[model samples]
Target chain A: MEKCKKNRKLIWLTIYNELSSEQKSQLEIHLQACSDCQSDYEEALRLRRALDEKIQVAPTAAQLEASRAELHQRLLLLSQPRLQKSWFDKVWQIVSLDFAPSWRFATAVALLTFGVLIGNFYSRKAATEYNFYQQQISELLESNISNIESVTYDPVTRQVAIELNTLNDFTIQGNIEKPEIQQLLAHSIVVRYQNLSIRKKIPESD
Target chain B: MGNEEELLIRRAQRGNLKAFEDLVKRYDEKIMRLIFNMVSDAEDTRDIYQEVFLKAYQSITNFRFASEFYTWLYRIAVNTCINFRKRKTIVQHDSLDSYLDGNNDNWQILNTSEIRNPEEQLINKELSEQIQKSIDRLPARQKSVFVLKHYHGYKLSEIAVIMNCSEGTVKNYMFRAVQKLKISLQGYQQL
Candidate 1:
């Protein structure tokens, strides 16, 4: 067979009646010229005949009727509302990916839910950070002097001495709601800004 | 398909049970036979028959007028047959002499009832069984190609369309199947 390898396909195609008349003629000429191809062609014919001689069977009329009847019953059942569920159907419904579209929809829903959750977390964090900055800004706008290091209240004198955290150590002693106490705080803020401006000016001078 | 059959399919797609049943009646026998030929078991064939049509029903709405309706249906039927199991029986080894070697082997004897001569009857009956086994032993592609060609009388080109392969591939499958059958049947009866 390997001796006439090209004709192997041609032999089968001819046996199967798939070749055109021109192709059949071409194969015939090759077969006539090549003894190996001739033998192959003859062998292929014998095999085709052997198969043709075999008996063939199909479903019986009775079997067909039973199948059709069964199908009809199933179709009728499909039409009617089902009162009960089989355990397998219930299980399959739960477990089945329910095909591609539903699985994709579930994934989309999950990703959206996840996105909402992440958004919620970051927004809450942003709100907390905003509140923290608001407190700092309010403190700055109101009294300006911050980072009160320590306080000592002298009960007999009715005086509060607050030590301020600044570039230089400083203390203010006054009644809590007194105008003098407010003046000290304002003065401290002015000195702090003055120092900040001087620091910026130094950088430019350098 | 005729106009009426086409119309019936359209109605079936729209969920008309009567139209569907009418359509089923037209092709059910042939479909069942094709399934039976592939599986070679009545019981398995029936189960496949129901599954094929049920699948067709479930997916019919998606069936646009793509090819011939039977081609579409055969695609479903053949795919079900292929997926159902490649070869139901363990492929028999090269040839046993005794015709009734295994009665349990579900090889159907066809057209043997009409044989009057006892000796010829035996050969014919046994030869059919042997041939069927020879066919079953082929690889799935080769088996399907031979079955669709030999049993169903499908042109190789048509089979390519049905099997979703090129005609050249179908012919190659046919050649390989014949070669396998030739080797398998050689040990037993000539046919």
Candidate 2:
């Protein structure tokens, strides 16, 4: 004889099925020897019969229709588009800075990286250009002031030259030829003209 | 109802509204009855039954022919009933007096001939009712297993899928449910 282990659960399930002829014989042999399994099987059939009676019950047809209608309406309501958001959705959107679909996430990351790179490059170029312009302006101003201080011999030329420097480099150009120097030059020219007048006595060549 | 249910599920999954409506017409009663058995409240059972079907409708798109349509529907019904019961704190208990009175009265009407009194019928009904009470007293999971298995004729594997449990777990539940019911129906043969 094969070792027929009595699996209690297998016996319980077998009670409900159309047992094979051999399985029926086996069950009979087992039941004849095992009172516990037999009683369990009998109780299961009794409980099933009771449940079947309960299932035979019917409700009013109108109530059934009403339930269907009500549920249909409820489902429709749920299906309708309404502004529903998760409570934390906005907060997450603000704080996350990384929420997107897979493709969109990748695109957004690429765009952000591109933006940062462009911004950094432009800012560095602008700073370098600004420093260069400051150096050029300072050099121009220094050269204009030095030119004014060094001008001396021709007074009329000096005025015209100073005027040109002031017009071109007004920021640092200033008056450097002194008034006393102008007056001395004017007086020396006058004395020379007077000595020539005394030597020739009849001065007019009218 | 069975064939029509199968056909409607097939056609509904294919996007046939008329077929789905016909299916609803066919099963509307049984669906309500099953929910009523689980929940016991008229309003709640009715609502749950409708919601179960609506869910079935919406989820028909995801449904595959892995199991019988009614099996899938039964899963929806059972889950909806369980959720409804949990949310509303509703529990079903055995109606002992109603069971006894209803059975005795029906028998009295059927057995018009006093000479042929079928006393065994009454005893059988009582025995079955006591067993039902024992099933009722079992924990919710065990009771559902007992109902799905013994009443609905669901296979263990089907029950496992519907209940979302391992087959071994379903077997364990059925085993314990049967053991408790057998003890509760003690002296049933003498009844």
Candidate 3:
């Protein structure tokens, strides 16, 4: 009849080692009337006492010392390898373990690399542009020298007299219209001097 | 309680190996017994015993005086047993029937009033071994609590500190363990 109860397992554990004095008296009174629960109580007590009396056997001293030595050796091995490593090596290992470069750190580094590349690209582009301008200035200076050396010019005022004093022939000429040539030569000198002044200013920008 | 042991512990925490070995010598027996009562294998007991002291040796520098040294050692023993239980796939082996020196050589008189005969004496020995098997069969936490409470005679509060649990939890584990042990050993009565 007691076996059909749902909480019988829990009840068995409850009465395994514990019962109040009143509960014990009550159980005793009930056991006197019932043979089944009496057998249950006796069996339970027997099991409990057997477990209580179970003794703990001690370890042999030899075995104890041997095991201790073996364990110490194992720990010593684990602690040994790192001792030979330099401080930098240890720091690197620790940093690698603890603060690995996550996606965020990688992204930051990648962005930094990208920025440096862009800056270098712009700097190289500016250097090439400056060089190109310098080459243009040198070509302009060479053109100015060819024009000045091919024409007869006054060395003091640095004027090009145009065809009026051509360096091709030095003989005196007759029947040449001198006044018209002088007007034309005067205008060519003014234009050539102005162009030379403008060409000279271009070198200052270099 | 010895001044020399106290001095050794202090020196061990300062990274002295000789002092650590001295501390190991002092508590090795007690720690071995504490582990033996759990696994009950001489070989495994020796293994766990070594691990406990080795752990103490390795971490001694970090040992603060937060608790008694013995308590700290006991905690290490319990933890090693628990970890051993986890790493081990299965702990059940054949019985110690062949191994026990059963020549009736060292049978001390156990409670002369209760013991009856050689047959009863044999039954007692078998019963003790059966109880040990039943204890090994317990869940790891329950077995640890029961061993600490029953064999080592630790207070529930003391066990709580070592186990890093509440006293109520320790007592509850002990209760459940005892109940389970009772049921498991009941099968032996038929033998």
Question: In terms of TM-score, which candidate is strongest?
Answer: 1
What fraction of the true interface contacts does model 3 reproduce?
0.33
lDDT, model 1, position A25: 97
Tens-place lDDT digits, model 3, residues B135-178: 88898888988887767767677788888899678767876786
Better of 1 and 3 by lDDT: 1
Model 2, B40: alpha-carbon shift in Å? 2.2
Ranking by lDDT: 1, 3, 2
* Local lDDT at B22 for model 2: 69
Summarize candidate 2's per-residue lDDT along B71-166 as a digit string, tens digits: 677788878877775787546553434423444221112222321334744554565456555665788778777777765577888888888889
Off by over 4 Å in 2: A1-11, A33-56, A75-206, B1-17, B90-133, B164-168, B187-191
lDDT of 1 by residue, B2-68 (tens): 8998899999998999998898898888788788777776678888999998888878898888777
Worst lDDT window (10 residues) for model 3 chain A? A197-206
- Which has the better lDDT: candidate 1, or candidate 2? 1
Query: Which DockQ-derived CAPRI band holds candidate 3?
Result: incorrect
TM-score of each: 0.62, 0.52, 0.54
Two-way DockQ contest, 2 vs 3, winner: 3
